[model samples]
Target: MPTARIYQRPKNAMQSGKARTDRWQLEYEPAEPQRPDPLTGWAGSGDTRGQIRLGFPTMEAAVAYAEREGVAYTVVPAPTKTLKLQSYADNFK
Candidate 1:
């Protein structure tokens, strides 16, 4: 059985911007363990089913895609972080 993970893209930690935040990503959790490549010595997985990432503008779109593909998925909610308001004048104080 394949399981899909749906999650919202987080705003950049250093800088908060709308860029990339509106998109949601649907990814497949690898069902098989990763193995090292014999020649290159790089870790790789034999199962490629869940390696692709599908991005959607809305959560509904992502969910719909998963449903249409007959993929069992679990939604991972984005963490909430509150920003404290500040003013440039406060720096002079």
Candidate 2:
């Protein structure tokens, strides 16, 4: 059996937009460690499951799928976001 993790997507650091952050994602734990390829020196892994990512509209849906598949899974709570309210004028201070 493979172990998986369920969590909500976080906002991308490169952009101010919050698009796609509402979806939950399921990712399998690495079955094997990555090793540098002998030819290209790029990191590679034989575990194809590591490349798979499943998205669900809600956390419950994600968990249900994992349960139906008999996959051992752990739900990682999403990190809380704290907003600091400030006006553009504050930048001048």
Candidate 3:
């Protein structure tokens, strides 16, 4: 049986904007460990399912799709966001 994980997309660390972070993503767990190719010396795996990522607008939709497809999935809760509220003037202090 193929195992999958459903989770909310996290904000990219490269940018401050949170675009597309509201969506949930479904990804399959790797069936086998990756190995370095003998000729190219590049890490590769025979399981192509690891490259597949399905996105849904909501967590419920992602879960529904997993159930409908008979895919065993686990929901990974999104991390909580915390903001340190500070004013520009505080820097002077």
Candidate 4:
């Protein structure tokens, strides 16, 4: 069976606002291996799985779609950030 993944999109490191964190993504795991092209002598672009990223507004919606499509998927939770907010003046302390 082809395997898939359902996961919440983590906030980009440079992102200060929570614009994209609320969206979840569904992606398939690559079933092929990267092979070198004989003609070009360069590694062929075989990471086709990441070419399609299905985004949903909620995690439940993402999961539901995967189930409805009969896709075997594993949910990967987003990493939690526990940093306390600090002020610029706190640096002086």
> Could you say which candidate leads in lDDT?
2
Pick out the ten consecutive residues of candidate 3 with the lowest summed lDDT: 1-10
- Would you list the C-alpha lDDT of every candidate in the order shown? 0.88, 0.98, 0.97, 0.84
Off by over 4 Å in 4: 45-50
Residue 16, candidate 1: Cα error in Å is: 4.6
* TM-score of candidate 4 against the unseen true structure: 0.79
Q: Global CA lDDT of candidate 3, please?
A: 0.97
lDDT of 3 at 80: 99
For residues 43-79, write the lDDT of model 3, one tens digit per residue. Answer: 9999999999999999999999999999999999999
- When 1 and 2 are scored with lDDT, the better candidate is 2
lDDT of 2 by residue, 1-93 (tens): 999999999999999999999999999999999999999999999999999999999999999999999999999999999999999999999
| Candidate 2 least-lDDT 10 residues | 43-52
Error of 1 at 44 (Å): 0.5
- lDDT tens string, model 1, 51-76? 69989988899999889989999999
Question: lDDT tens digits, residues 6-68, model 4?
Answer: 888777778687787878899988778768899998875666765788999988998898889
Q: What range of 10 consecutive residues in model 4 has the weakest lDDT sum?
A: 43-52
Clash numbers, per candidate: 0, 0, 0, 0
Off by over 4 Å in 2: none
